[model samples]
Target: MMIEAAAKMAQWLRLEDGFTLIAHTSPDGDTIGSSLAMFYILTCMGKRVQVVCEHIVPYLYSFLPYAEAFNTPDTAEKSYKNAIAIDCADKNRMGKAVGIYNASMLTGSIDHHKTNTAYGDYVLHDENASATGELVFHLWQHLGVAVEKSKTALDIACSLFTAISTDTGNFSYCNATPGSFRAAAALVEYGIDIAEINRLVYRTLPIGKTRLIGYVLSSMRLYNDARIGAAILLWEDFLRFGAIPEDVEGIIDYIRDVDSIEIAMILRQTQKGDFKVSMRSKRYADVSAIAGRFGGGGHLRAAGCTMQGQPEAILEQLLQVSTDALGQ
Candidate 1:
């Protein structure tokens, strides 16, 4: 059942002595930032907590405050009494960490995804939130954290700023709500190192990921009179370029940025020897419905689903769906 009383969610968290905070697989800015923000909050309350993820925290995100708090499921100690998922839409997205999350005596989640499956015992979710970090900002109001600038406040604000900034495309995407801008403005008052964050989050790119970008551009495919664009990250590409899972984070958006593309997708070969597609739309196409057709869910503009098949055959199949979606 959906949790109705918002304060109860905060109360549930307040009552816990320790917690295992889980970030979804691939560890995007929103998930990592939300997890770290909560980590700071819970620690400040004298609670023992640790953040866990399925994979190594991406280098791009390691500069954030409490970046060292993340642990792989195997490495994380089992001392936490409760579990809470941050920014995860579903349990499967928790990857290997889902085992610990399931075993907790008390379970909760803080998420903004509209496709959330209500998998937690207590869920604080708002589909209208621009980012899960934004939801965390509001939750802090109830937790007795002052809005004044302090070291703790600055750290919290830095994480929240990254969460809101990256998820909303640096405040340029349509998802950037008034609340999103307002939260950013409020966070800015804490004096987060915005210039350094901009350089790390946007201006910096590792050589491996840089090379992978070249491969993606050179190998991109356009279909349906250039209305749809896609790039495939083959298994060999990982080995040849030494690119990690996080390296592929925003590659799909690059495909969608093209002027003629209505739908953009990235067909990636998962480490488990299966395939999954990350999708995005420029306008008007309900990609969540398309991803839902194959047991995936996200926002109208972005979504993804795992699949098992030959990659080439899968591309052919998705092209037909894209064509039908666009009435081409």
Candidate 2:
């Protein structure tokens, strides 16, 4: 069935021109990588392809191939005959790019999220595929796009490596299955600089982000006998350290590290005065279901939602849910 979907997507790409590919809002490694992989593949096939994301590619991902090539909604062409949304679970998650996606005559989506609602004319969703990059890799194979022969093979390798590595927590997360390892091994055969990529993603951090982490650690609170940990990053927190949204990317992991904590959460105040809540669970708990209650969804252990509320109130509500999920 997956192969059939890939073949269908390949057919669409072959049958159409003027294609536009979209990544999710606040684009992450998987989304950006999948989008770029498709961009390179389509471009190689002599198709006119454009990639767009609602937010800037975070500084950490600037090293990716064609990272700068992704246009914003304002810069992308208004009309496209074909569209493919990569790693985005729903249409609304396409953010500003929804206009372009919806305008396209033929639309499809390729994703690896379990919660995906199959939103497209053609949808290929595999909850078991570790990362969307894995699916994209297979799609490229099904299309007979030889990585070794393609000029953009290195770029494809780097993008897929970043996508799978980051999404699986550097191969440490439970989602890192045998297939993830196989995919990573294949990408490694392309001779990607694994150490450098790790340094860029896991080790490199700006002073501002360091300070922000300190602030968050200093203020983090534990609840339900340390079964739940919560932190709040107010707008002032960003201003104080000259931090950006990307700076808060991995802070929730620290909360998850607390001994015996089943759930961790971070509430960050967005520029729009709304709070973006990131949730993580060390085990058993289904954070995605918790996030869905607030109109958000993601993987079981990791999920997020955005709501308008004071930090305290939001934290209270999330803690209630987290504890209840843990049966504590």
Best by TM-score: 2
Instruction: Tell me the tens digit of each residue's lDDT in model 1 across 1-328.
Output: 1235468887887777889999999888999988988888888888898999998777888899879768999998787889999999999989999999988898998898989998878888999889999988888766775545678888888998999999998899889999899999888888988899989999898888888888998899999888899888888898899897768978887889899999999999988878888999988887887888888889999999987899998888888787888874
The digit string of per-residue lDDT tens for model 2 on 1-328 reads: 2878878878887888998999999999999988998898888888899999999998889999899999998999876788889998889999999999988888999999998989888888899999999998888777877558355888888888899998998999889999999988988888888999999988989998999999988988888887888888988889989998878978888889888789999999988899999999987999999999899999999999998877888888887777779965
> Native-vs-model 2 lDDT?
0.88
Instruction: Provide the lDDT at 11 for model 2.
Output: 86
RMSD of each: 4.8, 4.4
lDDT of 1: 0.87
TM-scores for every candidate against the unseen true structure: 0.74, 0.78
TM-score result, candidate 2: 0.78
